[model samples]
Target: MSLFNIFNVSASGMSAQSVRLNTTASNLANANSVASSAGETYRARQPVFAAEMAKANQGQVGTGVQIKGIVESDKPMLKEYMPDHPMADKEGFIYKPNVNVMEEMANMISASRSYQMNVQVADAAKSMLQQTLRIGKS
Candidate 1:
């Protein structure tokens, strides 16, 4: 792949990771929100990604990443017995999101690292191109 292609790939990766980070943050923010019913409870959202492929001269090459879609987890929501809670339903139950705080934190860290790595890759590519130009100047 060309150095310019590296920039495009890195940019796409960074964008995808940004979306992931945002969704993770949203999930964490709503993790504690209580609901009177399961239907009203927040569901943890996750970003789906696909590898973009290009038909190059040599077979096919990966171009970059693309967002497939955002999906909500199918895991069951948490049900708690809070008889006196304002949000309690007819059965004295309060529904909470199934979001696992620890899991979300891990995801946040991973997304952050992935984004950083993409930036480093772009920077490295830029440096390599600059060095190539300097060789021409000399």
Candidate 2:
């Protein structure tokens, strides 16, 4: 791949990491949310990423990534019994979002690191390009 292609690849990676971060943020925000019923309960969400084959291979210069979809967690919610809880149901049980805070925090950290790595990749590519241009000057 050409040096220029590195930017595209890194850009795609950054985009993917951004989606991951957003999902983690959403999960964290709803971590303490409660619902009276399963249907109304917030579910943890995650983004589904797929290779951008068309962008990566088109004209023999395929390198970009794309987001496929965002998926809701199928895991069951945590039911807590708190009679004093205002949001509790008739049984004094409240349904919390299925998201696990620790898992989401880990995901957030991973996404952040991935984003930083992509930025570093882009910066390195830029430096390489600059050095290549210097060769022309010489």
Candidate 3:
């Protein structure tokens, strides 16, 4: 692979990580949100990523990562009998989101680290290119 490919790969990684971080942040923000019914309750969301391939002279080569889509978790929502709650249903039951605070926090941390790593990779590639250009100079 060429040095230019490193920049593309790193950029894709950073974009994917950004989406993941945003999804995790949204999930965490709604972790404690309560709703009157199951349909109205928030569900944890996850970003789907896939390897992007490009047609090259040597058949196919991986270009970078791509975001396929975002999916909502199927985990059962937390149902609690809180009669005094303002958003309780007719049966005095309140519905909470299925989002797990701990899990979302961990995912956020991982995404953030991945983004930082990608940035480092791109920076390294840029420095290498600059040094290569200066090699022929006085």
Runs of candidate 1 with Cα error greater than 4 angstroms are 54-60
Residue pairs clashing in model 2 are 56-62, 56-63, 57-62
Q: Comparing 1 and 3 by lDDT, which wins?
A: 1
lDDT of 2 by residue, 1-138 (tens): 798888888998999999999989989998988888788999999999888887646665646778998999999989988889888899999899999899999999999999999999999999999999999999
Q: List per-candidate RMSD values in Å.
A: 1.6, 1.5, 1.7
lDDT of 3 at 45: 97
Given candidate 1, what's the lDDT at residue 55? 41
lDDT of each: 0.94, 0.90, 0.91
Each model's TM-score? 0.95, 0.92, 0.93
Candidate 3 residue pairs in backbone clash? none
**Per-residue lDDT tens digits of candidate 1, residues 1-138?**
689989888999999999999999999999999999999999999999987744443554547888999999999999999999999999999999999999999999999999999999999999999999999999
Q: What's the residue-level lDDT of 119 in candidate 2?
A: 99
Q: How big is the RMSD of model 2?
A: 1.5
- Each prediction's total of clashing residue pairs, residues at least 3 apart in sequence or on different chains, is 0, 3, 0
Q: Candidate 3 lDDT, tens digit per residue, 31-91?
A: 8999999999999999999877443435545478889999999999999999999999999
Q: Candidate 1 vs candidate 2: which has greater lDDT? A: 1
- Judged by lDDT relative to the true structure, which candidate is superior, 2 or 3? 3
